[model samples]
Target: MRRELPGLGSDPASVRQRIEGMEQILERMFVVPGINKPVGLDVILSLIPGVGTISAAALGSYIAWEARNLGMSKWQVARMAGNIGFDMLLGAIPVIGAIPDFFFRSNTRNLRIVRKHLDKKHPGSRTLDVQATPGA
Candidate 1:
């Protein structure tokens, strides 16, 4: 039989780490030339022909689910949902939508909320940035 451990993966700090992982992939995986900021799978996926925004939003919902598990308030959770909603709604608009997706960065915004909640409730532990490749 396999056993799960406490204060490990399921704990608040671990949750923050996990959130960072998701945010790293979805929001900061790459860099654009000239502007010199990171971009991630969220924007790349948004560029897909169809079902892209939905798929990204679905992945985003996982963060909200994690927040609920972390005991965040209904308001905070709703705000996070609101962020995703805006991202998806705008992201659905085609060319113009993709442009905004490049800048909206909803995952980063949501992660900020999740990390703030964890940092407040679980003192001493700090939110850490996910490792990323250097952008050109």
Candidate 2:
């Protein structure tokens, strides 16, 4: 039997969920101890220098690729690519790179672009936000 991947469906809803999950993993997987700010693989991996930055870029590019598959305009995809490129440049810096990576959040930005496009063109794919009550 073949093992199926999660969120690999070609439907817009599946794509939206997939990209959202990726953005979450790349940009907000954990909270810093004292700072309490969320940080993800993008920031952590970027500390490894060349290979890490490239790996993050590749993962970021996957979002753009999904956008392209959804028939998003070339200009929009280009903008997403530009965001990733700029992020890679920042991550290339020594020591200080992760600091900027912590702030910039290219994957989150790309997710915003993708969400807007999906909301506008594929409204049915939109996911609702549900906040939990403090003591419920």
Candidate 3:
């Protein structure tokens, strides 16, 4: 419905929408169970040599930017970065890395962190106001 954030009008709504879309992309593209054993995009792309893994890392960086925009602290951002770094490092090892990607779901983890921080910054920013009124 209405996605405004205080006085920011539609700007915050646009950002929120983008973040939600990105989260969906991460979840559907990498986290859902599939007929092919549910391997994630990170591992599947890693099979393409240098470019593939790098692309995955780039996507991770985009998530980091969104996290920052969502008011996530530097420490939290660092943790997400470390997770992606670890994914890249471990994903370098042939078949083992790919399998881990299927289970790791780093994108999903980062998405949750971003959503949490955003909600903390702007309560009810993305949901209906169903909580009891203070006077009621």
- Say which candidate scores most in TM-score: 2
What are the models' TM-scores? 0.85, 0.91, 0.69
Error of 1 at 135 (Å): 14
User: What is the overall TM-score of model 3 with all chains considered together?
Assistant: 0.69
- Model 3 C-alpha lDDT per residue in residues 63-93, reported as the tens digit of each score: 7787777667999999889877876776666
Candidate 2 overall lDDT versus native: 0.92
Model 2 C-alpha lDDT per residue in residues 1-136, reported as the tens digit of each score: 8655766779899999999989989998988999968899999989997999999999999999999999999999999999999999999997689999999999999999999999999999999966455589
> In angstroms, how far off is 8's CA in candidate 3?
14
TM-score of decoy 2: 0.91
> By the lDDT metric, which is better: model 1 or model 3?
1
lDDT of 1: 0.83
The candidate scoring highest on lDDT is 2
TM-score of 1: 0.85
How many backbone clashes does every candidate have? 0, 0, 0
Q: Against the true structure, candidate 3 has what lDDT?
A: 0.66
Off by over 4 Å in 2: 1-6, 131-136
User: How do all the candidates rank in terms of lDDT, highest first?
Assistant: 2, 1, 3
